[model samples]
Target: MKDAWKRWGAEDERGALNLIGPDEVRRAVSLVKSGEVVSLAQPLSSKTPGPKHRCGLQHFMNRDGGDYAAGGRRPGGFQFSEDSVVMPLHIGTHIDALCHAWYDDELYNGFAGNSIRSTSGASRLGVDKMPPIVTRAVLLDFVQLRGKPLAADYSIGRADLLEAAAAADVQIGRGDAVLIRTGWLESQTGVTDVSFDIEPGIDVEAALWLAERDVALIGADNYAIEVLPFPAGKVFPVHQRLIRDYGVPLLEGLSLEEIASRKRSTFLLMASALPIVGATGSPLAPTAVL
Candidate 1:
């Protein structure tokens, strides 16, 4: 385990944070010694930005002569510029903290309130409460399990997940973060644009299955982890069920190519979500260690 920690570069925050305790390291060692494999989940993002996509701001200050600094140094004489961006929470590779979604305006176990709040309510479980998710992770390669890539318009049911797990020689477990690879990340380059016209993901049964297994999180390599073009006016029942009903987090738009390529089971699983107090979600780089 100590040896593994040494392999990490100083610039790797996730790896550095992971080295804090011996427990995670020991567990990782045990898995490796026992021949277990590891995988990382990628957040789904688009090349084309949308209303719900990611946005960022850049503040610039010219050192020669453009912006103004509070210090009043003439290095710039003038010194600041700002820019803004807008995008959906679902864009890029991100994790949907417990506050990411809600039920008929209520959250899991029926919290109160109308909007996302910091207290007990449907929108109360903001991303701020999400701690670092360091646990055992198992990858379910639906694409490989199916002997092909997940169809662009594919529908994943609980049964399909069961089949995928079997193919991977893995089983869902309590507190386990299950990452299902649909191989959809590769399709990003092929699409002319990122469209909501994309597909739906796991069905209700699969949602229930994850809930039943007591999974901490469920992730996939697609925009939304359920079949889309929703039947009628359904606004992502799967997300609703997991976040609002089961109180579980969901990760989407993950790139599992590296993990899938390993074709092994068990590994050190580590991931993070931004500690944005009032935000619904944040972008992050989740990784796996062998």
Candidate 2:
């Protein structure tokens, strides 16, 4: 872990994202063939399930001709409508900022966790520091590789990632965005359990492997990018290793069924966390261009 922190630099905050340069963007652009785009975000609504501590979206609309009307009538009695939404930053498909996780008392880049927070939010390593991500995205469909939807207790390790990549005939490269599809999200319809229900995700060993490869970001269709009902005595070890130690961001609650349906191994991915200053995370709307 110490070596992981030192590999980037003492002053760096963007971490693995630094691997994506002009060349990477150009390479990503070259992967687009069909010009078809698929959104990777789940629809946000009042019924949307989220973490226990986070509330789902609250949408308010001002319709035409009501007491809270959007505006006055136009030339031919035309009016406008307006809407607003409020929800936790991590509710939907989202990116975790460098400040989103910490080990003991320190955050990524060695920022003291307690000292960096106030009523407003984190004073350093906020989501606003995250740059727009444009890179090659590789989909590793574990459901297809394993011939079944992984069980809640299943832990995907380095071997699973390697085998999936090999099976897809795609090479995971530095600065690339990797989307792991466990089919968990797709299986959640009509589920009575809360959003925090057990789900399959990468294990700590696989996280370290990704960190070594310099992946810019890793996302999944599960609620969290790491297996839930965490191994006894281990509290989000994978998250600590990836975010706190390696400075790599996590994208959770992604919608990958559409992208996976295409059966393409590589595509152009565009995703950017909302630049909310001092925020620990931000809602994201990632897209895959095929």
Q: Where does candidate 1 have its weakest 10-residue lDDT segment? A: 10-19
Candidate 2: residue pairs that collide? none
Least well predicted 10-residue stretch by lDDT in candidate 2: 64-73
For residue 136, what is the lDDT in candidate 2?
A: 95
Q: Each model's RMSD to truth, in Å?
A: 9.7, 2.1
Q: After superposition, how far is residue 47 of candidate 2 from its true place, in Å?
A: 1.1
lDDT of 2 by residue, 1-290 (tens): 54356566777778778889999999999999999999999988888888777777999975645743545557576556778888899887889998988888888878788846577787778888899999999899988887878897688999989999999998788889999999888888787666585889999889888888888999999988998878889888888988888888999999988888899989999988888989989988999999
- Estimated TM-score for each candidate: 0.73, 0.93
